[model samples]
Every structure is written in C-alpha cells, then in structure tokens.
Target chain A: MDIKNILISVDASDNAMRAVDYAASILANAEGVRVTLLYIERAPNRDKFDDEAAWLNQCKLDHDRVFDFLKTARQKLVAAGLPEASVHERTVLCSAEPSIAQTILDVQQAEGFGTLVVGRRGLTKGEEFLFGSVSSKLVHNAKNCAVWVVQ
Target chain B: MPESVRELVERFKPPVSVRTYGTVFTDTTEFMNIGYGDVIKLGGRYYLVLGDERERRFGMEDPKFWVKRCVEMESGQYRILKLEFQESFDQHIGSLTITCHRSAAKEARILRLVAGDMRFMQGLGVRDERGNLARVLERVAGRRLDLNIEDLHQSHREYFQETFPGILQRFIGACRAIHHLHQHGETHGDIRRDHLYVDHKTGEYCWIDFDYGYDSVENPFGLDLFGLGNILSFITGKGVHTIQDVDAEALGITEADCALFFRHRVVNLRKLFPYIPADLNNVLMHYSAQSEVFYESVPELLADLEPCLENLRRA
Candidate 1:
C-alpha cells in the first residue's frame, strides 16, 4: 500500500517516457518515495566487434545514452517535486540473445520492489510483441507486486 | 367434462419443462410431454422431450411454473409467457410446444447471464440437457475447499510462516488496491474468504466474485477491512468467535460494549500475529490502526504501509 520503492523499466520510447511521467505523477505526492530508473540495452555481439576493446567501447556508448536519458528523466522527476536523493538510476547490458522478460523478472525479484511500472509500448517491434505494447506480459508473470501499464 | 377432468385441469402438474429451452407438443401446439425430461435433439438446433411417465406428467404443468418462477425470481427484467406452438409441431408424433416467457428471454438476451449465476441449480445435480445449471460444471470440478483461519494455521502453517512477510506485503498491497478502487468510486461489498483467490503458484492474492460488489466510493474500505482483520485473526488461531469476541478483546472492551467499541477495538496485526518481526509488526500495526481511522479511504493506510515495507526490507 505504501509504495515507497518503485521500479520502472523504460526503453526511451515516447510511450515509455510517458509511462515514466505517469509514475512520477503518482508518486510525487508521497513524502519520501524512492524511484529506481532502469534501462536495459541489448548487448552487442562479441563476434560483431573485432575484439573485447571494441565491445567495451560500444557498451560504454550505450551506457552513456542510457545515463543521459536517466539524467533527463531524473530532472523531470525533480521538477515534478520528487527529491533528488529519493531518485536512483541504473543501466544494464542485457545480452540480446536471452529473453528480456526473464531478465526483467529476475531484476524485479532481486530488487524487492513494491511496484513494477512499465510502458504499454517499448522500442522495438519484437519487444512490443513479446512484452506486449504495454508490458502486459509482466502483469501476467510478475509475482508479489502490482503491474501498472500507462497508456 | 366431468369432475376429474376439471380437477386435472385445475391441478395439472406445473409445466415440468417450463424453463427448459425446448418442449415437444402436437401440430396444434398443445402440450405433448413435460418436466425433468431429457431434451432429445430432433435436428440441428431443434429438440424434443424424451422422458418416461414421471417426466411426461411433469411436462404437463412444470413449464408454466418454470416460466412463472423465473419471472418471480428475477423481477427487474422482462417476463416470459408461454409461446403458442408453431406448425413445426405437426411433424412430430406428440406435438412440441415452444413456450417462452417474453420478459425472461429478453433479460437473458440483454443481461448475458454468466455461468456463475446459474451455478446454484447446477449444484443441485439437475442435468437433462438444455445445458444444466452453471453450478453443475463448477461442482463437477469438485466442491470448493472451505478454508477458515484454522486451516491456514494448521495445513498452511509452514507456507504461512515461511511466507509471512510476503503475505503481509500482499495484504498491504490489497489494501492499497482497495484504496485506489475507492478513489475511483467503487466498493467491493463482499470480502469473504470465498471471494478471495490466493494463487499458490505465485503467492499473489486476487479479489473475485463481484456479484454483490458496489461501485460507490463511500465506506468501501470498511467492507473488506473488518473481514480481512478477522481472517488474520482466524489464521493466527485467535478462535472462531463472533466479531464481537475478537474485536472486543483487541479493543479491550466487554461484550456488552462491543457495539460502541466495534470499529475502535480492531486488533493490530502485530498483536494478532505475534510471530511477525518487530519492524514488520510496526508497519502492520501502523496500517491496521490507520485502516480503522480511515476506514472510509485507503490512501492514508497505503501511505503508512509503503514506508513500513521499506523499513522492514532494510531491517
């Protein structure tokens, strides 16, 4: 009931961003709610990159974009009245070959978040179909938390 | 034209196939066969009455009663009157009468009754085609398990003890869900054990059976709050006494004064479930008390639950 810790998975799409906006609005009124912004990047192929160095550089760039987006989102939350201290951000290199849904579920369980908020649509068409336009799969699969899909 | 004929007409058995989808009659649409009889499909969707002497006798009058009873049972919708037999009845040996209550047919057509509504009749184990009562299918799966708080303590003790934290967390979440629903102007009127389905696979609990649920914001929280508290009490072996006994004890009042102390005397989760961790207990107590104070809304209680959950996780 007390949604102190919120886990929102964003993919930088307009819809995903809108979902983040909705989540911020819902939690903004609370006195001390902590929001964790998670962005997952599909890991580039080790074979595609000539060597580990190339892969590392590409990963760094991907992390930068994720961080930059989080930075922008963090500002939005603060602008919406959330304390800067209460907001946390993270980006992970999710190996493209593995299922993203499985990864999200693992992260959610590990994090022990009270609520999981996701956009109805994500970045890729495949992602949209697999996770649904609004992450309906998460709602059906996730345990112990309420899944909110913002239109 | 004798006394027996008059008597037979006056006391004719209630139309046995009254509510049934199809009835058989003569070319003139006069009654041919009736009550608790098997409906034999004559062709594609058409059916005929096929039962022995008892069913034939029942068919004589039961259909009329069935239509009348259904009208009386569900008053709001339209009524179904016995429809006159059509030319189709001429082909059959015994004329097949197609009787229908107009209002009842309209109600069924408009309302789109779910199987659950007819489950009671199904439970009675009456199946003679025309699709048995909804209850029959449900009962066929097996009668529902009646779970009391004692069962939670005994059979599910390990599951409860191991997953107490999650249970408390979900309970708080349920409170929040109810709170949200209230804000949207809805109240889940019945919060009994039967209405709540706990998925053993995921430890998630969902509220179902909304037949009597109300879509009003006013006092929705109390509808489930008291029931939830009592369930918790029952689970912890607090005894199956009336709400007065448990509520009075929790509130520290005598039975005679329970009416006055009713809402105020509700027990906190920590007090009721002593084995809960101190921090978690604090959170439970905070929301439990808040539920009493804001028995009308869930927002405040949810706000309290949020922080307590975080603090418990940290501890």
Candidate 2:
C-alpha cells in the first residue's frame, strides 16, 4: 500500500545510526521495499557574526561530513540484509529552515516518500529548552505520513 | 476566588513583614506604606524597590499597582517584582458569557512552561524559603501598545490610510504568538492593549501579563479571542469610540444600525465608518450584540484576519 519507499534521515550521530538499524531490521526480507538515506546539510544560523568566508568554510565541512554519513547509512542498510540495488542515498543542501523537522518533511513531500523515519536525539530538558527538540516537532507537525521515531 | 471586596483586599495583602537589613525610613503611618529604597529578601536575594518610574516627556509612567519596579541588589539590573494580586472578571457578548481571572500561581506555572519562548515576557518564577511564590521578570525596554497608540497624534482617517495597515500586520504577528501559547496548552489569561509590548530593540510584539486567564469549558480561548477583538476594534477606531461620540450627522449612522456593549461602547464600525471593508468588519462584528456566530478560537480569528491583511496589503 503506498508504503513502498521509506526515507530515513541520517546526521552522522549515534542516534541516527539507531534509526538506520531500525530500518534495516524491518526490511530484512520485504521485497520491493526501497530505502533512501536522507542527509540534510543544514546551514548554520549565524545570527551575530558577519564573517562570510569562515561561515562558508564551516558549512562546506559540515556538508561533506553529512554526505559521508549518508554513504555509511546506505552501506549499513544493505549489509543488514536489504537488497543492494534497493537502497539509495540522497543529500539535500538546505538553508536553515524554521526547524530541521520541517525541512525533512518538505523533502519527503516533494519526492513522494510514503514513510518518514527520524532518530530522537538524547538531549536533556535544559538543552531542549535552549534549542528545540526536532523529533518532537516532527511528531507533532507530521500529517498524512506515518512517522517512525527511533528513540 | 473573591466574592466580596474584603476578600479581594485580602488577596492582595501587602508584604509588610520584611525584616529590613537597616531601618531606612520608619514612617509607617501612611496606608500600606512601602515605598522607594525598601529592601526585601526573596529567595535569599535582596531587592531594592524603586519609585514609580518617571519620564520627562510623558510625566509619571503608568504605575503598575500589581507589580513593583525593583533593582536586584547583587546584579543592579532592573526587574519587575510580581506581587500577590488575584482578580477575576465577567463579561457578556450576546449569548456568550465569559469569565476571566488574575491568578499569580497559574502565571508562575505558565512562565515555567513558556520559559524559552521569546514572544512572552522573560522571567523566573522564584519562591522564598518559607514557600512564598513570586516572579522576577526582566525590565524590558519596550513601548506598551496602549501608550504607543496614545503617542500617535494622527486623525483616524489619516492613521487608517497611512500607519494602520503596518500595525495590523504586526498585530497579526502578536496573534500568532498567542496561538503559540495556546498550542502549548496555555492561554494568555489577560490580553490588553497595555499587555502587548513592542520591544524597542527587536521590534517584536512581546505579550507581557499572562497572569490573567479563564476556565471556560465550552470555549477555553473565547475570552482571549474577544480580548483580541476588542484590541483590533480599539486600534481601528483610533481609540475606544464610546456610543456618545458617534453620531448620524458626523458618521451617517445611529445607535440602531450599530452594535454597542452593555456599557454603551460602540462595537459596530460600519455604522461609524462605511469605508471599512465588509470582510474585515464581519470579524469585528463577531463580538457585537447582534453577533449570532462567534469566533471559537484564535486560529478561527486568524483565518479571517489573514485574508483581510492580504486584501489590505493588495489595496
């Protein structure tokens, strides 16, 4: 049923790998289950600073690192028993959206992905209070899409 | 909680039990005599209560009777010390009856919930050792919307054409901020023109007093939406257009064509000014005496406001 393609977001973090592991465990034998590893190369918010060159350099390094994580996630999914031909990698170079969760959903909607998977990063209430909890934002705002959150 | 005047007075019992570090002024003859240079210990920290802030341009500022302007003894930064003031009110619009409250404890809980939200007044819900809950908010540098409007010395038609559209856009921003608070399962219990502050530095319409709220099981945000409606009407009419000020000779309509509150405040704007678009006027009329259908929520109010904003922008 329209749940053929599942998009799993990877960020080179241990929690993101857990999401990859969960996806791998589910698609061991499910035929025609296409898995896409999504890496969002988010632009860092530079609020007070005006240094253009340093910011661009940092963004490039961050993009390359996330792109490497995308390949690693794809390999993990294939090695865990999914078909090598079915798993694909996608990297989106995105500006800072209102929230990262919104960017993930926007890409999912545009590419016709049926299912969305995200990893709930381990952040304390104090940290989440300062910076928002992305996985929580996704869980609340995701509509017309089945979301599998790996805590 | 207060059903009588005595109970209401008891609710706002002044903090006269503070064991001052030094006897600065012992003139305790005046009624409720606590004034400038007074030191009170809260949460083991001392604060020096300041006099009513004055402005050379506008004379003495609006004295916040509920809260006092104080300076933290250690930091020297100004802060708003929220005092124990509990109040509630009831208002009716047509068939809808709304009850609102001024709850200090409820505001403390809400401040904790919306601690990280920038749209709200930044503060900490502090308590003393013996368990007296209070709040110490940052002394924000901003202009209250009420005073901001009072400073605008333009005619109603001139303001409506030139500056009102931009202000309406900002008002929409405030409405969205209210929606954010509602999303977190909290209501800005009191929505007043003075409660909405425009930060001088950020230009963001930050909502200040959240200590006021309602517990309408039928419509939780009904009073809030009505409060927002009143603000909208106030801004549109340049000020509160009492029924006495409006006339058939000046505006081409009488009391029969207009909707007035129980206190005889004019609600209907089409009778006063026919130039107001029907789409926008309809939303304003939703809180009138003749209003059969009412705005149930903030989002419902926003749905009508957004299009009206777009239409105004286009025109």
Candidate 3:
C-alpha cells in the first residue's frame, strides 16, 4: 500500500493507454507517489524489408511519437490531481531487441519502482498469441516489483 | 426368505423370474431382466447391485452400480436373470437388495423424458459436447487435433503446423463467448477445450457448462484466460513447457512443482487421426496473448481478437 515509485511503460497502443490510465488511478490515491514514464525504442533490422537508414529514421519518428504520448499522459495525470513534479519521463534507445522483456526488468530494478504497469501487448510477441501471452518473461524477470499488465 | 431381502424386493413388484448366483439375484422385468438381490445380469441388459446386509444394518450404504445392457429381444423371449449371493449361509445378506428389471420401451421412454430434458442435455452438452465438435473438425495436413492438454506430447511435433490457420477464427468465437459471459457478470471458471463445443456445420464455438461458474465483482478473468491459453497448448500438443510455451504461467508461480507438472503434461490427439490443419497455431497464439490481459475481462480481449479474426478469414 505504500507505493513510493510507479513505472508505467507504454507502447502507444490502446492497451498501453489503458495501463497509463490505471497507473494514474493508483497514483491518484497514494500520497507522494512518483511516476516514471519509460518507452524502450524498438531495434532496427527487425523489419525484414527496411534498410538501416530507413529504420533509423523510423525510429526517430517513433521517438517523437513516444514523447508526444508521454506528454499527453503526464497532463492527464496532472488533471486528475497528481503533482506534476512527481511525474518524470525517460526513453532508452535500443535496437528492437527481442529482449524487451529483459529491458523492462532491468528498468524496473534500476528505478526501484514498487509497481510496474504495462499494456497487455507491446513489443513482446505478435498479436496471434494474445491471451496466453508470452509476456511471462517480463513478469518472471522482474526482481521485486509487482507487475500489473493492463489488458 | 430373509426379512430384509424379502422387504427390499417387495419395495418393487416381483420379477417374472428370479435366479440366485454368487452374491446377487437376477430379476427379470417384462422387457429387461434386472439383476437384484446381489449383482446379477438379467437378459444381458440389467444389473442390480446389492448392499451387504450387515452394512445396511449399520446404516452403511449398498453398492450402487447400475449396468445398462443393449440387447436385441426376440418376439417371445421372456426376461430372465441369474443371481448370486455373496454369503449363502447368511439368512439376510445385506440391508439393501438391488432389483434389476429389463426396462421396457415405455420405461425407457419415461426415463428419457425425465433425464433427457433440455436442461440436462444443456448440462451434458456443456461438459461432453466438445467431443462431438472435435470429431467434426477436419483433420489438418494428415495430423489430428489434440482437443485438450492431456494430448500434448504425442501431437507436439505437428502442433504448430496444424493450428496456425484456423486458430484465429476459433479464438474470435471464444473471445466473443467469453465477452458475453463477462458482460453478464459471470466468469467461465473452466474454459478447457472439453467445455467448448464447435458447431459442425458452421465451425462456430459455443461454451458449455455453467457448473462451478462464478459471478463476482473481482472477476477471475485471468484464471479463465489462462484456462483458454492452457487449452491452446493442449489442442496444439505443445504441452505448456515454459511461460513462452504457455500463458497460464503469467500468475507468477515460476519454479514450483506445479509449473514442472505443466511442463510434462501430455495429450495425444494426433494418434487418433492424422489430418489436422496448421492454421490453428495462430489461434493458439492469439488466445495466449489474451490470457495475459484477462484481468481486463473478456470484452477487451474480444475487441483485440475481432481484427485478427477478420484477417484470418481474409487469408
């Protein structure tokens, strides 16, 4: 119940947005709760057809989009009465690593968040295997934080 | 005549013929011969199992086993049974005497009316109806469909190939059914393949069995979602080896003995038939992903599945 730091990872999908809403709701109740919005950049060369330069440019565009998404998410939290200073944003530039699960785990540990909120789907696995999600890696690899996957 | 056995038999009308065997009696009704007294076979169709008289006196229950035999009756054959008593010396063998009667067509009809009511069929349809659908689902690529987790190992190698194509659509239907249940504030506690019935004509899936179901504010969608994922692994014969292989592990119990059990569970659908399609793989994956998000309820999962189903249909 003593939630000190909360980490919300977003992929800009509707599901991820739901996670943001959930994080905001939890943060809304806790006193002095700090929220960190993190987005891991998808690696290049994963798309079979895209060339290196094209992938890099797309990554930049994706970065800007992430920034915009975080900005909007932060404002929504503020409007919902969370202190603006308590909210922070960070982005890691990594190749579209199949190890997003590992990256999420690493970030959660490094930041020492009590709770980690994530969308049901992100960069982990494809859409087909949605329910019995392969998202286990993220939950399994997390050291101490309780991971809440927003569907 | 022992008072107990005589009284037990008197509870029902006298059989056309009664014969004693080891510890049972055979009672012949008009159309069928029921084995009563002990355990007997009458006209090869009915079996009456008796309880020990001592056990009955002590308020212990009798053995309750009813055997129904399918036989062709001749026009003039009278029902007859051969009975046996467990202890020949005991005057009153058991507290309960089982009367076996050949159920006449009229009796069978009455029983059907009482037992085969729509509600009962619906209940049975919910539990065992999946078998009927599994039979109709065409075998894909010379491989059979493993309908449950018990069939994993024997069907594993061909699982991925057999499930990829048709899986998405099946998932869409499942999601829809789950969504409907959630909307009504009900949770399908058991979402196993055996609980699902696939329409033979339309390939549409219907969820059967409302028994053990729950309706609560804290909906355990995750549990049901995981059950769905478990079914996918079962149907695909992958057998849920790792979290990567299954969605049920999302509950956070990673190194427990239960996890190990999941890893070794075996189901063998391929051995039965060899033509299951490969399209079901996609469906398995879709359901697995949805399982992760089950806490959000079934409607959200169905929304995610709708487009996936459309894509599969287009393909």
Candidate 2 per-residue C-alpha lDDT over B143-236 given as tens digits, one digit per residue, 9 for 90 to 100:
8886788789897778777888888998998998888877776678678787888889877788887776554222345557767987888787
Compare the candidates by TM-score and give the number of the best one. 2
Stretches of model 2 off by over 4 angstroms after superposition: A1-151, B1-34, B51-66, B85-101, B249-263
Q: For model 3, how does the per-residue alpha-carbon lDDT over B203-309 read when each residue is reduced to its tens digit? A: 55555433232211112354566566566555444433444433434434232212111433322222222343333333333333222323245565555545554
Per-residue alpha-carbon lDDT of candidate 1 for residues B99-132, written as tens digits (9 for 90 to 100): 2112212122212332343221111122123431
DockQ metric for all predictions: 0.01, 0.01, 0.01
Scored against the native two-chain complex, candidate 3 gets a DockQ of: 0.01
Candidate 3 segments whose C-alpha is farther than 4 A from its true place: A44-47, A50-53, A96-98, A122-135, B1-270, B273-315
Error of 3 at B285 (Å): 15
Best by lDDT: 2
- Candidate achieving higher TM-score, 1 or 3: 3
Across residues A1-151, which tens digit of lDDT does each residue of candidate 2 receive?
2477888887778899899989888877788888888877656533212245865887788778877777878887888888888888877765423346777888778877888888987754322322346687677777667889998
Worst 10 residues of 2 chain B by lDDT: B22-31
